[model samples]
Target: MLDQIPLEHILLLSAALFTIGILAVITKRHAVVVLMGIELIFNAANLNLVAFSRHDPVLMQGQMFSLFVILVAAAEAAVALAIVLRVYQHFKTANLNQIVTKEG
Candidate 1:
């Protein structure tokens, strides 16, 4: 049943998600929302990797790469959140613009 869907459909969905994630990162002012957008972008890439891996059962490289990406994303999120927390503690706000202006 799952095999009935074409690969193009999955790729298209991944592209859409990636675009939305880009928009979120660009337009959102809050640190947490930007982090969420970054996560979305990572998931979009993961989706593409998994979808491609499904076509090739012999070499699971795509799946392996996706796992590595997930691990890296987790570490990135943790570090980014720690930084955001520290910034919030100092500035009392999560807005990136305010933080930047305050620094200058």
Candidate 2:
């Protein structure tokens, strides 16, 4: 017998993951934590895309799009991390709250 779990289950999981990411982005003061939160949100979106792709073999657009999203996320992370490193070197702090002053 085919597994009968409803599509709602996947959507629920995606919602939970998205909520966690939003919470992380809002509550964490560290720049890295915010970056991680952003990544989590992207991952959740990718999960949804893959789940949708599974039901249709002829049209794998969702899967292909997810792959592109993953690649973009990776590149974004690399560039963001490098920028964070530079900021830290100049400011000696990784806290997002501390870096917002115009003086710096």
Candidate 3:
């Protein structure tokens, strides 16, 4: 089924998703939303990796790298959420601007 779709289309979709993720990360002030954006970015990369892997005949290196990327993303999310929780506990808010502007 995937073979029916052209590689260019897949790449375009991935690029669009990545761009949206970038916008969300840059524009959102909430930590959770930013984290979600980061996940979106990861997913976009995963899509590209999988799409490219379909064309390869000898080795599935792209799929392997995608798996590694997923593993790293999961670990990163766990650590980032822990840090966000600590920041919220210390600052009493998840707003990035407010947290930064407040005096320690």
Candidate 4:
């Protein structure tokens, strides 16, 4: 079944996901939305990794790398969200455009 689908199709799907993620990251002002976009980007890369590793049933290097990427992404999300929470607590807003630092 998987053999019937061409590699181009999988690549196209991943590319589309990556594009959407980029657009979200570029256009959205909300910190959570930015984080979601980052997650989407990570997922897109994971999809590409799985698609390319589908052929290598023996070694599965791409799959292993994808797992590592997932771990890294998870850690990034935890730390980033913590920072965002702190920023929100200080500013009382999650909007990136509205966040400003006060300097004396």
Candidate 5:
């Protein structure tokens, strides 16, 4: 099915997703939004990996790497959210700028 679509198209899509993720991470002040941006970046990388691996009949290195990426992203999100929750509980805000500004 993916063979019908050109690799260039897949690459373009991933590039766009990566750009959006970068922009979100740079512009968003909320900790959760930043985490979402990080996830988007991970997804973009996974998409590229899967696209490149689709043609492989053996080894499937890209697919395996993508799976690891997903696992790591999940672990990262969980830990990041836990930290965010703790920060929010202490500071009463999830906005990174506010938290930082108030810190001594």
Candidate 6:
């Protein structure tokens, strides 16, 4: 039943997802939420790359690069979360504004 939709519609959805990610990054102050926003941004970018690759199947570089990006993003998220946890253990708070205070 979903095959009737055009390719342009999929592209538009990707654009909307990207916009939502930007909005999340701008509106959220919590570290975890911001990280989630970054993930959304990465996913949106990957979706766009895949969409472009769909038209030119022979040139697989974009898709390969996007896969690497996804892997790097995963690693970044893991390391970032670990750092955030350490900071929380030391400071007793996860709020970015509080962590940036002079007290350290």
Top-TM-score structure, candidate number: 5
lDDT of 3 by residue, 3-104 (tens): 899999999999999998999999999999999999999999999998999989469899999999999999999999999999999999998988865478
lDDT comparing candidate 3 with the true structure: 0.94
What TM-score does prediction 2 earn? 0.88
lDDT per residue, candidate 2, 1-104, as tens digits? 11266668877888888899999999999989999999989989998997777788589988899999999999999999999999999889999888865674
- Residue-wise C-alpha lDDT for candidate 5, range 7-60, written one tens digit per residue: 999999999999999999999999999999999999999999999998784879
Q: List the residue pairs that clash in candidate 6.
A: none
Candidate 1 stretches greater than 4 Å from native: 101-104
Local accuracy by lDDT, each model: 0.93, 0.89, 0.94, 0.94, 0.94, 0.83
Answer with 2 or 6, whichever has the higher TM-score: 2
TM-score of each: 0.90, 0.88, 0.91, 0.92, 0.93, 0.86
Predicted structure 5, TM vs. truth: 0.93
TM-score of 3: 0.91
Weakest 10 consecutive residues of candidate 1 by summed lDDT: 95-104
Estimate, for each residue in 1-104, the C-alpha lDDT of model 4 and write its tens digit. 65678999989999999999999999999999999999999999999998988888789899899999999999999999999999999999999999998899
Error of 3 at 88 (Å): 0.5
Worst 10 residues of 6 by lDDT: 1-10
lDDT of 6 at 64: 98
Model 1 residue pairs with clashes? none
Off by over 4 Å in 5: 101-104
Report the number of clashing residue pairs per model. Answer: 0, 0, 0, 0, 0, 0
- In the predicted model 2, the residue pairs found to clash are none
- Model 4 TM-score (2 dp): 0.92
Give candidate 5's error at residue 7 in angstroms.
Answer: 0.3
